[model samples]
Target: MAKSATLYRMATDEHICPFGLKSKDLLKRKGYELDDNLLTSREETDAFKNKHDVKTTPQTFIDNERIGGYDELRSYFNKSEAGQQGTTYTPVLAIFAVTLLMAFAFSYASNFALLSLNTAELFVALTMGVLAIQKLRDLFSFTNSFITYDLLAMKVVRYAYVYPFLEAFVSIGMIAALPAYTVAPISLFIGGVGAVSVIKAVYIDKRELKCACVGGDSNVPLGFVSLTENLFMIGAGVWMFIK
Candidate 1:
């Protein structure tokens, strides 16, 4: 027990260089102060990282709480009511889900949710009207992103979106009762097109293109980050159809 306590304290004394604001902020926010734990040596910190699965040296460990990575930290922070309630997109997400449900109904049953074709068409038109309003709301909600400074200092794209715009059309087509010949070929073509656009942007433009899909960031240029984000998005759209 004595050795364990000694090793833990020593490991946290900043590790390798004994610097960086992350460690300072972690300690100060807990009200413990730094000198309380700064005397521990560097060798022990490296040893602790090896002994445990920890990749970070100045990370927090409160009680038996999880020593988390990025994803875990996100889940923890966003799980609180304070974290969840402050979003301007709740209503939008609800409407989007409703739209998806309507789409799914139209796709699977060949009729929009228990209604006759003519009747369903009218209802669907009304739903699309609602969706148009939601889209405007979504644009407004994300408008402030233009001025926000990302800690990652992510770059914006200069030119792109010719392909993803097409893919978005195909994704809509996939859930509709378009001619089978038209449906399969167009979807595959759109997916291939999006893939090419992403690769070219990443390898050539070399900046992350933001407006390709999520219109959130003002269309960033093609780059590693943009390529990664686009691939993930395309992957997500593909994964929706395990059926």
Candidate 2:
């Protein structure tokens, strides 16, 4: 006989528990015959919670054993919590994807051209802005990770804190089509230093480490992607100087 499970979850008109849906999907995927008990009103949800002596909804039971919530169910099945740990390119890929779309959108809106030099420039600038925003979200955390591999950050700790702001400034200046004199120097300096740091840490020393490109808490590995980011800034700086 197929395994059987019971799930009590919230499904109200005003609010639906996302975790509840996740639990239901997981049970179905795991080949469990699920008894999906929906608590459709606040009173019903509260009653269910009170009766079970649980603090939250989306409770599950497998073979009559209580499996607390969505996270608990995942743990019971020996599944890793989503995006909680491990090396991932998700953040970086997401930034790139969004910036690419923005570049195309802006280019088309302004000049009716989807592909142009301006599009390329916009893509790079927007990427810098987004990446800088991620770092700025938690400057302390970002600097802690950045100092591990960045030579400038190690020698002058304050530089790590200033780095994200510099990126944001350059991004804005480039997008605004400001004179190269104002932005190119900063871009060149940061990008040059970043490229050297990444090379020494990853290529020369061969030390495996996480990147602060996305943020301090991120699991993005330090290597090619990081190097490419620096190279992009360098190229943009040079382009600005020439154009």
Alpha-carbon lDDT of model 1? 0.40
- Write the residue-wise lDDT of candidate 2 on 16-89 in tens digits: 99999999999999999999999999999899888889999999999888989998999999998854577888
**Top-TM-score candidate index:** 2
For model 1, the stretches where C-alpha displacement exceeds 4 angstroms are 1-169, 203-205, 216-243
| Per-model TM against the reference | 0.27, 0.80
What lDDT would candidate 2 get against the real structure?
Answer: 0.94
Quote model 2's TM-score.
Answer: 0.80
Q: Give the best candidate by lDDT.
A: 2
Segments in model 2 whose C-alpha atoms lie over 4 Å from true places: 1-5, 9-18, 25-58, 62-68, 71-81
- Mind giving the per-residue lDDT tens digits that candidate 1 earns over 119-215? 3333333343453343244453333331122211123321122333334444444445444454345445434444565565555556343432233
Local distance difference test values of all predictions, in order:
0.40, 0.94
Worst lDDT 10-window in candidate 1: 1-10
